[model samples]
Target: MSTIESRETSAISGDAGLSLIELIIYILLSSLLLSAMAVVLVNSWSTQKDVASVTQATNRGQVIGSAIERAMRNALDFDVDDATGTELRVRTSLGGNLACQAFLLKDGDARFTTSSGALPTLASDWARWENGIAQYASTPFFVENGDVVTYTFDIETDSAPVRFSGEAAARSTATGVSSPCW
Candidate 1:
């Protein structure tokens, strides 16, 4: 009976507290697991940011490119505004006699706005198609071959640049002078 009691007491004490080695091992393993999780979280965040940037650039490039193509395909008259081919104006079949649509690249951004019979005199009239364009990667220009017109644009992202190319034809030539919209 005495031996049995001593054994029971020893068993209870053995289960009461962890040895120092056991405690230290548990702490070390927990710290290692937590640090690994933190690293995974940081990597996931960086990948998400890059994906968002690329998506934004691609969406902007596609929307702007398609709009220009559509306008040219149904254009009543088309003209380039400047010698550098940076500005293009289209008088669409749907537009009023004194209205036009202007597309241009300025200050490293692709911009668009409506105009009266002539182009707007103030730069404030223009609005950006999207936010934050890399100036070095952008080259928005027009190339007209007879009735067919071609446009090209390069939209820059953090990873790679998106290139847009479109070609279309106008219904007729301009009835008046060059820079007809202006």
Candidate 2:
């Protein structure tokens, strides 16, 4: 064995993997990194949940508002048989007789119901019945001049309630195309 070989052997033997402090430091650093990642993940999840709630609430509100507005606006002709606080019977050019109204379900959830043609037909003529809607706390829907319906809507959401108020006037001036349906 030469001097160089002996020195190499000693160096190799003296080599150790890691000191205790180095191992502990590495563990602590990794723990801190994992904690940071966990915090970020939790915050991201919370923000996403909040955004979803707002989006759902906004969508519901828009649907309810637009449906009523469109029901009054888009009619080639319409008749207002009964328009009240919690009930509306407006036969539009779209939904025929026995069409639409706002009422509470058996479980107390308020909603709108609309049908395409008269009932007793085959394919479910119900266009779309948006649920989770309520009359506004202060003032509900009321009729003006027997053709314009003014309403305040309350949309139920998981976080909080949303409200919208507007007045919709029927564009119809037809004489007696069809008798009004309830």
Candidate 3:
């Protein structure tokens, strides 16, 4: 064969395949890249779960806060039931003899019960948090002075507990009237 042909054949044979060391190095690099990617994916998923937990807790807090504020605003008179500060009894003129009682259940849920007429019996839960995901960290309480009523409580969640507070004024000037449902 010609010298040129021999040189060409030698070059082709030399460049035909990768060395064992080069192959091993490539595999290691690929494995490293995959590991990094997996870590990043895991971290992202964890962050998402945390965000969702917080959002759910916040929404639940808002709902409970709004309900309490509405009840307080419509109340002609109200009483806080126990030293634990978990119970509130509100009487509204709009509902006639009907009254609302908000209390914390044994399972850490907050609920409302409404009753009307003389010799009133226990009623169904008006607003209940029974999902078992969110709970009351502290008993809810009210601070009343003159015509203003303030409600405050803490709701517990997986990530962090949220504090909810709100104030409402009575629609009528009549205060200290005896509640029929008492």
> Candidate 2 on 1-182: residue-level lDDT in tens?
99999999998887747778889999999999999999999999988887787688678767666777777764434443243345444556654432433322111244455555432222133334556666665464444455677766666665667766777877765443433433
In Å, residue 87's CA in model 1 sits off its true spot by 1.6
Task: Kindly indicate the candidate among 1 and 3 with the higher lDDT.
Answer: 1
Q: Would you list the rank order by TM-score, best first?
A: 3, 1, 2
Model 3 CA lDDT for position 54: 72
lDDT of 3 by residue, 1-182 (tens): 99999999999999999999999999999999999999999999988988887788789877767766676677777766446555566676656434544544334566666666432334243556544323244534666566776667665666676766778777855567645656
When 1 and 2 are scored with TM-score, the better candidate is: 1
| Runs with alpha carbons beyond 4 Å of true place in candidate 3 | 96-99, 105-107, 118-140
**Model 1 CA RMSD to the hidden true structure, in angstroms:** 3.2
Q: Which candidate model has the greater TM-score, 1 or 3?
A: 3
Task: Evaluate model 3: give its TM-score.
Answer: 0.78
Worst 10 residues of 1 by lDDT: 131-140
| Candidate 2: residue pairs that collide | none
State every prediction's TM-score relative to the real structure.
0.77, 0.62, 0.78
Q: What do the candidate models score in CA lDDT, each in turn?
A: 0.72, 0.58, 0.65
Residue 163, candidate 1: alpha-carbon lDDT: 67
The local lDDT score (0 to 100) that residue 74 gets in candidate 1 is: 63
